[model samples]
Target: MVGRSVTAVCLAAAVSGAAAWAGTQTQLPRAKALAFGGRPVAAQRHRQRQPSARPGVGVSMNVHEHHHDSGERYYGPASKPILDAVKSPADMKRLNLSELKQLANELRWETLEAVSKTGGHLGSSLGVIELTVALHYVYAAPEDRIVWDVSHQVYPHKILTGRRHRMHTLRQSGGISGFAKRSESEYDCFGAGHSSTSISAALGMSVGK
Candidate 1:
């Protein structure tokens, strides 16, 4: 059973939908934004740049030399669902703790595969892999919102919250979005792109509530 009192502090419950990405695109209403104290709410969008070949795409988690101990992420494309990886927030809840840990590894592996093809954030995803799994396992999706910042780390969020099938379409035109999109799912509440907007967005949400 998941700890009731909780051991680690966390982000919110981010879930639902697929986003369509374009060149150096601004991603608002489709990523980031969430409540404090790890309360689950719908996410806001975060518009940001997604240039082709900026850096840190497709690199392996263990293969890279830079700060692997510091938790380097590998958001590269992986072999097509060769494994039965969790694809949604509910999916995560259905698994046992041991299973969840394995799922996290696969998510990272899949993230590596996906990001490599599209060439986006990798390190952040790697660092947050365990955290993402725990959140999904704890909260129900489409209700709770967990905002991300500099949100290229959205890879793991996408896979767990029901966008695994579209992994290959990441960061592509007329494909999937790189940032969180409200249109994509109710899990997204506010939009973001630049930094310093996440906490404020969450605060506004609390006031509105």
Candidate 2:
């Protein structure tokens, strides 16, 4: 009887340990999700299980690693036919929603290609790709005065506003200034390098206008 009882306890302990191990393995992805922004574990699991609508269409968020090693630059086209057609913000206004989406992808690729060679504030520029497209599409620059704070983020804006050709000369001594400059282009209404200055500049422009 004692032998039987001992064996049963051992079996129960083994089962419990196995269950715990399995649970830990399942929770690993959720743990990674929490590291991003403390999202709930269940939501993370649900996202993991969900499939992407279009496979192989996702653009990599990471900056190109080749820029670190290669001396040769990427001089090829930044995007497909959609982006190639966009010469100015007025051109963007003509695009439908689907075309605009395609243009955004192209703009992103172009921005990456330019920055990969010249080396500028790539992250901020990339983060605002969609916003830059949207703003240019909706509002008229040079006239509307779309003042940008931390103008490091304005690479995409520059690309949309007829500065794509000069992107290769970015941040050089005689090249384009990395930050917003009214003299550089009329699209850059306010020139600022610090943060929290856009609101004041916008207000000043509003009053001045």
What does candidate 1's lDDT look like per residue over 49-145, in tens digits? 3333545653221211233245534233344342355555775566775565556656767776677677876666665666666666666755666
Clashes of each: 44, 0
Query: What lDDT, from 0 to 1, does candidate 1 have?
Result: 0.53
Best by TM-score: 2
- Model 2, 144-163: lDDT tens digits are 56767677888888888888
Candidate 1 least-lDDT 10 residues: 17-26
In model 2, the runs with Cα more than 4 Å from the true position are 1-79
Candidate 2 lDDT at 198 equals 68
In order, the Cα lDDT scores of the candidates are 0.53, 0.65
The residue-level lDDT of candidate 1 at 168 comes to 90
Off by over 4 Å in 1: 1-85
